[model samples]
Target: MSLPLDSPALALRAAIHGALAADAPLAALLGGAKVFDVPPKEADFPFVALGEAVVADWSTATERGTEHALTLHAFSRSGGRAEAMAIAAAVQEALHDMPLALAAHRLANLRATTAEVVRDPDGRTFHALVRFRAVTEPL
Candidate 1:
């Protein structure tokens, strides 16, 4: 049989993007559904962008699976880190322990691992890095 061609990481990212884009609370906080895999050069501040992701085999004796570690970045031009932190919190609320429909795979579990906010070197921009861990099994 030919090998199946499916990427759990990519599927997970797409599901995450869709979920965040459709979250009314997150939309209200960001002023819109300003979630992007690659934000435009002129993209507005206080937006969420998909960041890096790492996936590893998690197969069992009879199950094929993968574990994923993903990062999401929140950027804001507010005077302080409050906006960035708030955006990060909203992302966590929108995703943590939530079910995501992945192509060719099933999301076993997803959890927010950590979040950190910092002032950018520009001195006017704030950034928050939120990380999540998830396990996926082939369908």
Candidate 2:
């Protein structure tokens, strides 16, 4: 078997990007607003893209061949803390459960470093940090 050229981290990123894209109200609410802009309705809550993910090296922690780390920045524009957390939780669920781009990509572990509300100049922003691990079989 041949190893896939793309890394598991890239696959995870693609999944996340796809999930956000499919969330229409989220796209519109956040797309038109800035980092901490509040949305009128709960459904239109924004999912702001802070920046590109910083992937860490693979590690050996369990049965999985390797572990990976991805540092991503994002926020939701919601008024209530519960609403923001719900959105963040949904994001976390997607990252953990989404299928890998390649068959070789397998998720082994996942964690969320930050998933809370933050005070910014613009307003209250829902901030979150998602960390996940994946095992990619070598070709």
Candidate 3:
């Protein structure tokens, strides 16, 4: 009856990182698996960042669970929206309905909800935001 160290947020981020790193399509799009919670100094273009997650309790009569609101960001500086859009597609395809492992909980379900691609005000960078929902229960 010990408390779990892997919060819903941590589990979700780890799943995303693992999924993207393992997907060849997404790996190639980013020129490598470049998933991170924080991008490095002068990090390479076409990388991914795990953004904020708004979570809520989803307890049932028989089990404890959670519903997550997650955001994944794709960034590009190689110019144009094409690369960004393609990477976004790969991200969505990689995670949609795919299974993920949780360190301290069970992932009841995971699915992409919505996504959008846009050019930044700098006109040279492209940004794509992908959103997802997940249901988890304590293991």
Whole-model lDDT, model 3: 0.86
Per-residue alpha-carbon lDDT of candidate 2 for residues 1-139, written as tens digits (9 for 90 to 100): 5535566655555555665556655444456433322223443445544344555555555433444455444555566455555555655665564554543466554555555555456676666554444444322
Candidate 2: worst-modelled 10 consecutive residues by lDDT? 32-41
Top-scoring candidate (lDDT)? 1
Alpha carbon deviation, residue 53, candidate 3 (Å): 0.6
Write down the RMSD of all candidates, one decimal each: 2.7, 7.3, 2.6
Q: What is the TM-score of candidate 3?
A: 0.91
lDDT by residue for model 1 over 4-121, one digit each (tens)? Answer: 4587888899899999999999999899999999999999988999999888999999889999999999999978888999999999999999999999989999999999998989
Model 1: which residue pairs collide?
none
lDDT measured at residue 51 in model 3 versus the true structure, 0 to 100: 87
Candidate numbers sorted by lDDT from highest down: 1, 3, 2
How high a TM-score does candidate 2 get? 0.53
User: TM-score of the candidate numbered 1?
Assistant: 0.95
TM-score of each: 0.95, 0.53, 0.91
Task: Report the number of the highest-TM-score candidate.
Answer: 1
Model 3: lowest-lDDT 10 consecutive positions: 1-10
